[model samples]
Each structure stands twice: as C-alpha cells, then as structure tokens.
Target: MRAVLQRVSEASVTINGKLHSEIQDGLLVLLGITHNDTDEDIEYLVGKITNMRIFSDEAGLMNKSVADVQGSILVVSQFTLHAATKKGNRPSFIAAARPDQAIPLYEKFLFRLESTGTVAVKAGVFGADMKVRLLNDGPVTIVLDSKDKF
Candidate 1:
C-alpha cells in the first residue's frame, strides 16, 4: 500500500458533477493498493498519518499532529500511484492491485482509519471516476509506502 498525503485547508471529491464527499482543515490522502498489501500496511499508515506532526503549533513550529488540531481526512482510491514508469512514456500499472483484491483492502483501510476516532474520516467511492479539489495547506505533501518501511 502507498499513500500520498497532502495537508489541506479544504478538499472535496466530485463524481459526474455530483459531490461525493468533502473535508476541511485536514489531510487529503490518495491511496494506492498492490496485491501484497494487507492489514499490516493499513495499521502502519493509520498510525503514522493520525500522529504525524505536520500541522503547526501556536509557536509557529510544525509540532502538532492532525489529531491535536481536530482535523478531518478524505481518502481517495488512486491506483495510478503505483504506476511503473521506468521503461517507457506509457506507464505500467502492473504494480496496482486489481479491483477484486483491492476493494476489500480499501474498505478495511477506511474502517481502520475511522476506528481511530481521532479525526473525521470521509472517502471517495472505490473505482469511481472522481475529480478531487483541494486547497493545500502549507503545500505540504508526504508520500508513504509500506514496502519501504525501515
């Protein structure tokens, strides 16, 4: 599993011109899943994201976690995050998990995130054509991969 977490002042997801979900003052997470990903990956990321000290404190230092600021989170499925572009201009999606294997993991990840109860959790429909919009707070973005954990 991999995730691109962007700190955002506000974010929303639209599908076919209809609003799906939205969040304010939180993280907009673009999540990708591979065939090998499991609950462990979800656990690792949930802990990291909720506790990540990217938000600023009153002293103007980046010392507060999203939980500390009572933020929200909007997670979207983005299989393209795993695109392999080494060989050609046409990227390969062999690393992305097929829907049959991915949907369950995606649901489980969302469930776990919500279970944390530290922040409001919202999500985009899996496998839907979603248009996401956000006001990136601090323009802060972080990429995390379970396979690369050291």
Candidate 2:
C-alpha cells in the first residue's frame, strides 16, 4: 500500500456533479492498494498518519499532529499510484490490486482511521469518477509506502 497525504485547509470530492464528501482543516489522503497489502499495512499507515506532526504549533513549528489540531481526513482510492512506467510511455497498473481485493481493504482503512475517534473522517467513493478539490495547507505533502518502512 502507498499513500500520499496532503495537509489541506479544505477539501471536497464531487461525483457526477454531486458533492460526495468534504472536510475542513484536514488531511486529504490518496491511497493505493496492492494484492500483497494486509491489515498490518493498514495499521501502520493509520498510525503514522494520525500521529504525523506536520501541523504547525503556536510557535510556527511543525510540531502538532492532525489530532492535536482536531482536523478531519478525506481518503480517496487511487489505483494509479501503483503505475509502473519503466517500460513504454504508457504506464502499466500491474501492481495495483483488483477491485475485488482492493475495495475491502480500502473500506477497512477508512474504518480504522475513523475508529480513532479523535477526528472526523470522510471518504470518496471507491472506483468512482471523483473530482477532488483542496486548498493544501502549508502546501505540506508527504508520501508513505508500506514497503519502505525499513
């Protein structure tokens, strides 16, 4: 699993011109799953995301976690994160998990994030055509991969 976490002041997802979900002062997470990903990966990422000290403190230092700021989170499925581009110009998605394998894990990740109970959690519809909009707070973005924790 891989995730791109963007600290956003506001974010929203639209599907078919209808608002699906939105958040304020939160993290907008683009998540990707592979066939090898398991519950352990979900656990690790959730722990890291919720506790990440990217939010600024009163002294203007990035010393506060999202929970400390009482922010929300918006998770969106992004299979393209696994795209392989070493070959031809066209990117290949061979590393991405199929919907049957990915959907459940995606749901589980969202559930785990919400279960923390410290912040509100919203999500974009999996496999849907979603238009995401966000004002990236501090323009702070972080990339995490379950395979690279070591």
Worst 10 residues of 2 by lDDT: 111-120
Task: Assess candidate 2 and give its lDDT.
Answer: 0.96
**Which pairs clash in model 2?**
none
Per-residue alpha-carbon lDDT of candidate 1 for residues 28-101, written as tens digits (9 for 90 to 100): 99999999999999999999999999999999889999999999999999999999999979999999999999
Tens-digit lDDT track of model 2 for 1-150:
999999999999999999999999989999999989999999999999999999999999999999999999999999999999999999999999999999999999999999989789999999999999999988999999998999
Q: Name the runs in model 2 displaced over 4 angstroms.
A: none
The alpha-carbon deviation from the true structure for residue 118 of candidate 1, after best TM-score superposition, in angstroms, is 0.6
Clashes in each model (backbone N, CA, C under 3 Å)? 0, 0
User: Model 1 TM-score?
Assistant: 0.99
Provide the lowest-lDDT 10-residue window in model 1. Answer: 58-67
Candidate 1: global Cα-lDDT?
Answer: 0.96
